[model samples]
Target: SNHQSWVDTSIVQYISRDRLPLTRFFTKFELIYIPIVGQTFYFLDFPMMRRHSKQAVTKNPALAGKDIIEAKRACALLKDKPFTLLNYLEGTRFTPKKRNTQQSPYTHLLKPRAGGLALAINALGDEIDGILDMTIVYPDGVPTYGELWQGKIKRLGVDVRHIEIPDELFASLQDGGYENDSATKEQMFAWVEHLWRQKDERITSMLAEFEE
Candidate 1:
């Protein structure tokens, strides 16, 4: 789901606890070097990724692609099991400032980052049963974590979209379909744009009800 506020996790987990399996989130590798929190995630088997800088990769070619490889290996352990692996295609929480900075086409979202999503698809495409695209909205106005914790949250708007993986998209992932392939990458961008358009419209409709 596209992140809107800090309380989004609590909302999502609270609402979806029974509906979906417990999830494994993709986290920054540097977190592992932190104290107990990092170790907790590491022990929970979350995918820890080192987002290498271009300069860093240029300096050490061996570091190239290492994070994705490790993430995939961790995903492999979930094979034949029921688990939720989540990727936030937008990479970061959405704010009006970021939206304007990016000149994002969608009114309520940041531009989707393709590479990390592609890596996830490449790793878990075959095993994942369906693609679940969720858009979370707080029509009462987004609340801070403190407000939510203080019981200030009232209504929430959540749209859960489930779609079968398209054959062409799946094929591309199976056969090197990420940044390296122009056609496949273009197709992915188009699909993501389509999804975002629908999601934006849904948010519009959801907000309309708030006024009514």
Candidate 2:
């Protein structure tokens, strides 16, 4: 999904409450140190991932690829369970400043990351039901977490639908080619980029409806 703000987690939960299984999302490791909310996440058993900055990885070279190992371990733990694994492909919230910095091809998004999705597919291929694409738009404007609690965000748009995985790609991912084969990784990246492009257009159309 296109992440906008901290409120996205609640919105996701609200939408999937009755339809999906228990929701478990990948969270930043540092978040576990936060107050009550962090404790709640810990108690709920959400996966905590440490994302090393580029500079940090460069300095300690050994830190490279650690997140993947951690992510795989997390996915293994969830393989036998029924749960909605929510991954924010953008990796962070969207801001005009960030868009400019990234020089992203999509007008309304950052480049989508495929690593997490591939890992999930590789780990839980047989157990999964389907992959869903979720698009969220703040038609009025992106709201802060406080604004959400204050009932200040009046207009919003959310779309959720199943995403069909290409047969060849699906087979490759299920076989664990994503990590072992460079071509499979590139294919996964391309597939997700296509999804992000559609999402970018959808966001534009969704916001246009609010104007009318």
Candidate 3:
């Protein structure tokens, strides 16, 4: 669904983030934070969360067993159509201070939090064929949103790799009920871990190429 307007306004270059298009539809969970801004999103029918602790759910008498329920609700919202769900697994933009503090395993990636992705796979089950693992490299250096707007940033490299879901894992999802089946959940988790490992390797290879 490429919008011709995006290309017509000399926005193609500005819109490309590491060569990836700026606007795209997303499925799965999107965590939106902003007071007034979030309200507009809600008006448009976007899912909003108050941000609760996973531990609190276990300790509180009234809050037990809500994770599955929430995940299920999200699944219902995104069950159809091809959409891109934007998730920052690093949970935020990359910065030298944060990156060093986190000691990220991937050279250019933030450590992936697999829980959300796990829930998405469990909820969607076979509905999603696989994931498009994306890598955004800023040749000139990562730019803040403001910098990009000010026309201060230039040059970027983008790569998109489609990671195929292995048959075993797909079968596991098909046979095992997303929430109730333990085996399928474990398999999906393992698959996500494998993808993260490959991503780390790819980042290293890409950096080497950039240097050369």
Candidate 4:
């Protein structure tokens, strides 16, 4: 999904809770140490990833590929359970400042991150029913987490539909080629970028409907 704010979590649950299985998402490893909320997420089986910087991996070559291994391990844990795994492909909430900093080509989105989605597919592709593209729009302005709880947000739009993964690309991702092969990685990026462009246009259209 194209993330907008913290409120997106509740929105996703609101929209999917009944229709799907248990929902899980990836979280930063450090979150587990924060407080009650963090501990709760850990117990709920959220995948906690410790991402290493390129410089850190350069310093210790052994650190290379560890995150991918960890991600696959985390995903495999959910293989037997019926679950809806949500990856915010943009990797973070959208902000004007972030958009400019990223020099994003999309009018309403950041570039999609391919690795996380690839890892999920590699581990859980067969267990899941289908891939879904979810586009969320807050027709009122983007609200702060507190604003959402306070009932300040008046309008929202959410679209969720099945997306078919091309067979060749699906096979490549399922085989873990996305991590090891440059061509496969590029193919994944191109596919995700195409989706993001469509999502960006849909966001524009969703917002327009609010105006009318």
Model 2, 1-212: lDDT tens digits are 78989898889998898899878988887898899979987887777777777799999999976766787776677776678989899888989889989999988998888877887777677777899999999977888999989999887889999999998999898887887899999999989988999999999999899888
| TM-score of candidate 4 versus the correct structure, residues matched by position | 0.94
RMSD of each: 1.7, 2.3, 6.6, 1.4
Q: Each model's TM-score?
A: 0.92, 0.88, 0.67, 0.94
What's model 2's TM-score?
Answer: 0.88
Give the candidates in order of lDDT, highest first.
4, 2, 1, 3
lDDT (tens digit, per residue) of candidate 3 on 80-198: 54444444445455565665898865555556665565555655676765566665555555556666668775655445666787777665554434446777777766776677777
Q: Native-vs-model 2 lDDT?
A: 0.86
Where model 4 places Cα greater than 4 Å from the true spot, the runs are none
lDDT per residue as tens, model 1, 15-59:
669899877778887899899989998887777776787899899
Deviation of model 4 at 77, angstroms: 2.5
Off by over 4 Å in 3: 1-36, 80-82, 99-103, 171-189, 207-212
Q: In candidate 4, what are the lDDT values of residues 42-139, reduced to their tens digit?
A: 88888788888899999999998887778878877777678788889988899989999999998999888998889888877677679899999988
TM-score of candidate 1 on Cα atoms, chains taken together: 0.92
Spell out the clash pairs found in candidate 3: 25-84, 26-84, 26-85
Q: On lDDT, who's better, 2 or 3? A: 2
Count of clashing residue pairs in every prediction: 0, 0, 3, 0
How many clashes does the backbone of model 4 have?
0
